[model samples]
Target: MTKSSGADPRKTDVKVSLIGGHRLAGATLHERTVTASLIGGADIDLTDVGIPDGAELRITKLSLIGGVSLRVPRNVRVDVRGLRLGGVKDDGPSEPGGPTVRIDAWGLVGGVSIRRA
Candidate 1:
């Protein structure tokens, strides 16, 4: 329900708080150079959201109903924990070299795909 961003250039952090069963689609975060967190079960659609190099994206304690896709750059790290990818479509590359994507979806049922361009 709340979203906050840091002001300092050295601190590039974006925090998103979502309630359970909420639907979030077409959300994009760009150019920031820090970490992102999405908490709770929400339908999130992250298509064409460019994550910068060396940035960290963390999705924890949530169930992704609609799922999330990343057009991520090289050297970025993504961590997903307790996430459920339902009705997800993989439209990117299968190789895992652009970013160090770490997924810990213990309750995932759908599917997750990563592509490089």
Candidate 2:
């Protein structure tokens, strides 16, 4: 995927955006709530994901234009079967079920994956 010309996405300066060939990766995410958007050949590498005891972390939307590789914790579950036109969604490591990761994806012509961490 093409890298974004923007600033460091990991910085707080970037609120909620991962596009224009950008990239974002969170080392240890503990926020109970979260949102993400990807497009224009961008990439969001969420290495480690987390959530509260009985809460949920929602990835509002992941409109991939290039690709996305997210490594979720063994605790939380991934359900990124939101919306699609013509592309692919790979919620890697088929766990039984856990916390819901409601992902509204739009892989018009790109790739998306949620692997184990």
Candidate 3:
């Protein structure tokens, strides 16, 4: 599907991928919305999401079988809720309050981890 998200990178999709990653350290999503959908059996890694002030990033879907690892900049505000049929979810460091990163995660046999970068 195509979108007119305007300058912002459109929805990111990784299907049957062996590896996947995304960085947003010095990037701009200002006034833009970014969403990522991870579906399949690949292990995905997202780094520095919404760091140093960015836009609203929503992980609308995550149904990967290999799981996902999200490394966010410490002190950023994060809202995450993961449901696992059989796995675990790790919380990162204390949130000092910064940018916002929202996520709705789910897994069958995989897990999700939030690490402080």
Candidate 4:
């Protein structure tokens, strides 16, 4: 959240939390975003955000013993992949034709939950 130094609520990156939780929501995100946590967790919400047609939004995650919960709008396609020792629960893509969101989640002893907003 430190990189979002404007009144537009646009976020390019988020600070990692070690022993607490971080919530990033209601912001216009960049094409690429990164989030990580050591012993905490993060909650990301992207609702009513506009993404260009055929554009791709990439989100990379790194978690050690934490988890991440992501909520996306219903008009985008989601592609999730990674290497993890935990688990991932994806609700799959929303619509057939829309913007693409690629998520790369790499973690150990944590989980990722993705669902519609």
Best-fitting candidate, measured by TM-score? 4
lDDT of 4 by residue, 1-117 (tens): 123446644455656766676676635466667777777666778776777668777777777776778888888787878877767787865878888878787777667888886
TM-score: the better of candidates 1 and 4: 4
Candidate 2: misplaced stretches above 4 Å? Answer: 1-19, 27-42, 45-49, 62-64, 85-97
Q: Write the per-residue lDDT of candidate 3 for residues 23-85, one digit (tens) a residue.
A: 333243332223333444323233534344544455533454545555666765657666755
For model 2, how does the per-residue alpha-carbon lDDT over 1-117 read when each residue is reduced to its tens digit? 122235643322223566555454544232322344465533445444444445554444445554445566766666665555544445455455555555455556655566666
lDDT of 4 at 61: 77
Candidate number with greatest lDDT: 4
TM-scores for all predictions: 0.36, 0.53, 0.53, 0.76
Displacement of residue 37 (Cα, Å) in model 3 is: 8.9
Ranking by lDDT: 4, 2, 3, 1
lDDT of 2 at 74: 67
Q: What TM value does model 4 have?
A: 0.76
Model 2 Cα shift for residue 24 (angstroms): 3.0
What is the Cα-based lDDT of residue 87 in candidate 2?
49
Root-mean-square deviation of each candidate, in angstroms? 7.1, 8.2, 5.9, 4.3
